[model samples]
Target chain A: MRVLCCVKRVPAPGAKINITADGQDVDTAHLGFAMSPHEECAVEEAVQLCERFDGEATVLTLGPPEAEEQLRYAASLGVQKAVLLSTDGSSWDPQRTASAIASAIETLEAADGPFDLILFGNESADSGGYQVGIRAAHALGRPIVNAIKGIEPDLDAGTATAKREIDGGFELYNLPMPAVMGVKEGLNLPRYPTMRGRLASKKIEVSVMQAEADEGGQTRVTLKQPAETVSNTVKLGNGPEAAPAIVDLFEELGLL
Target chain B: MADILVLAETEDGAVVPATLEALTAARQLDGDVHVLLCGDSVDADDAAERLGEYGASTVHVGESDLLNVFGPEAWGQALALAIEEISPDVVLASGTSKGNEVLAMAAARLDLPFVANCTELPSELADDDEVELTRVQWGGSLLEQSQLSAETRIVSIAHHALEAESAGGSAAATETIDMEIDDLYARTQVVGREMAEAGVTLATAPIVFGGGRAVGSAEAFAPLEECASLMGGRVGCSRAVTNNGWRPHRDQVGQTGTRIAPELYVASGISGAIQHWVGAMASKQILAINTDPEANMVVKADYFVEGDLHQVIPAVAEEIKKRKA
Candidate 1:
């Protein structure tokens, strides 16, 4: 089995994000970056699946050149290869990103072999669009599942069972091969890179693909800052006295 | 005449709350409301009755063997087929994981413009129908309004963004439509299903007890669990807590995990990042407990306690116990 896990480098979840002074996009100069938390599970699942199924795991990313840092990180986690769709970091629209990723996957298939499985995080931690994986699956004409919490791959039967999170709990699903699966967090705890693994990863080569515009550049009418609500700060005591005040506050807020 | 198509999500043979909310929003339009139901032997009589009550004049049932196991491609194809059959003016679905995925593919395959997590309706509907929509941006701190041009409007409504209300009426007449099953395309099969750890879902919990990096360790989260249990609620965590392996990802409350709308949300040791706030901001009352007087959570909180979580949590738990006693 050949597994392809799509990874994205996003701003760290805890960072206080601010739109640049230009008011067009997020200010990235001071923000730290890492693999999207959900995508980490995808990469981890891909590595585990390959380990169990006796196959190779290839990590793919579509972003600016800095995204290569995440690809290298995936390599450090024992991913056999890394593919980067390096763009100029301007167009991060979901549809355009999906199209570019689909093209990159097609190129890889033409060079290597058809991938048996593709994995993606449910959504990017930064943009949280939650559309690219399914759109890519559609563009590639493949089956897909989103927000999968658990996966059971059956190599002999050439089918996979996935448990997806629904409104309440989850529903069981079975899908066939050459499918796309979007992994949510808690699917598996991603492993940290070992010293030996990191040394080996430093020697791995990364393939960078040229950027191309998606079908017809999807129009981005305007990018503006969202409205901010005023912060209402209230302080309370730490003991039993706080409870009534809390209740009174809830009553005032119409929460009780 | 233009018709709006709403995809009604069903779980375990029951219609989901968000689906009703979507149908309610769909009724605001001046076109016929058409609903699509997919499942293995969906009780069309019951579903159509509910859809009709929610203002759907026509319920289109797409029955397939593959419906038992959700095949995104197959479902998208089925929906695309339904769209062709109905020629809808708009296609709407709840922004649940599955709803967003299937509709995105359906929109992409049809080459139609699409938007996600829409909080408000577009200001205008014209030939181009470039609708302006509000979506949570900058980690829920800001709502960005943008426009999209498409002949057929496609959008996914953010769950909990709208309230769910029943439309009082008898069940509409049932109609069954046999959808073509592409077993070849449906290569994936569901082998089985397993439940997550037993607890009230954070999204629906009335009171959410949450922790952050300040909790220190997984063991320290025991107090939160106790508080949640005492309140008959559920426990939630910020991304930092989950990242540190202090809690399972399912318990994470944020943009990437599960957006929650609780009556009272209590944050312990959390510094309130924008993404985290965006998820829980819908809560009616927010209480933040942290030693840091200037924590972002303290600033946003309705009630702030400037004390160590280690001290505040046990004290609060004891107080709840005393109150119950």
Candidate 2:
């Protein structure tokens, strides 16, 4: 039951996101890079599945050479294999990203047997286009389900049941093996890399694959940060003393 | 030159607000707006009647047995048929869970690029073929404007992105498209659903009373709940509350959680993070109660009461009781 999980290197943004000077991208000089939150969960889920099912787990990323840091980080958490589809670091449009990933999947599967499940973050932390995973799945001709919170594969039955959270309860989706799923955060709490595991990860070799992608139709115009929502706080008094004032405000609101 | 195709979703026998909002967004584009109505026993004429008021030019009624079940496979199959029968330049739907999934399914089947949660689209495509797009990224915290030069571009309009307005008067006519589905359409279907909250959801509540980590424990949420009900609102919590296991994820208000645009949001003990700010920003007014005078929620709120929530909350509740009595 081999599983493949995809992750992206994104800046760990602070409360306020700063746009580039030219407004073409996010300003990341002071920020640390981490895997997209959802993909972090995906990598964790893939490793857990391997622990439970007794199989190999591979973590892949399509980014610059520095992205190997994210790959190695996943390796620290028990991933047996790490593949870096190294790119030039500039943001690749969703189409090119999907094409390169699909081609890479085909190449890797040709050497080893196909994975039972392929995972992706529901959407990238930055671009959040919400289509790359589905596009990659389409290119591979596999059924893809996004926004999945829970997944359980029945190896004997060759089916995987996916749980998606909606406004109310969850929805169940059952698909066959060799399927792709877009996972969201909160699916599971990702574990930290242990001291022994961190030491082991440093010695592991990373396989870096060049990403050859054709320029897609979509080109990025300038990226502008939407204006900040301005708010001014009017003191409604303080502590127990503010109770009457709040009640008065509530009365003004007709709540009382 | 091509028509704008809208997948008009229906709930409780009426056009959902999101779909109506999508129709409004469609009006921004060039050419006539043709809506694809995918449902069983749907009143094509009736829907066309209401939607015509909102600017639907032609209603394509897609009736099929496969439409009866809510599955991406079947929904995608039905929509793919509509897309093939009428090749529209741009496709739009509401950015609800169902809307995004079904369009993604159809896009996958058609082998096209589908954009999700678009806030703005070009009124007209460029002569060079690149369709301009501005979509919400990281929930509403940021916007990304890009281009999709596909022969056909699929998009889902973000909820509440556009104010829905009636164009006043029905369009010309309705066309019926009967669909033929295969067994593979049943590969994945929704077996059942259980409503998380029977009534008063976080987003729909008139007044949203939220709590944070400072609220202490799950059992301690009782006073907040009582206050919320008294104010005719519902109880919501911050991600910290959810992470701390004091509240369910559904009651969370944050970038990834449900965005609430209520008339008022009364947040207690919440040091608002940017993620939570994005969700609460849409509220008409915000009031924060926190021990720290400079908490993010306090600074961003319209009203602030610096105090301990455990004491302040009960005090506020008791004050209301005394005032009413």
lDDT of 1 by residue, B244-295 (tens): 8888888899876778888889998889887688888888878898888788
Residue B107 Cα positional deviation in candidate 2, in Å, after optimal superposition: 3.3
Q: Which of the numbered candidates is closest to the native, going by highest TM-score?
A: 2
Candidate 1 residues lying further than 4 Å off, grouped into runs, are A13-15, A238-256, B39-41, B68-70, B126-129, B137-139, B142-145, B165-176, B185-191, B196-199
Give the lDDT of residue B51 in candidate 2: 83
Candidate 2: misplaced stretches above 4 Å?
B11-14, B39-41, B126-128, B180-182, B213-223, B229-232
Alpha-carbon error at B82 in model 2, in Å? 2.5
What are the per-model DockQ values? 0.46, 0.51
User: Best by lDDT, which number?
Assistant: 2
* TM-score, chain B, predicted structure 1: 0.91
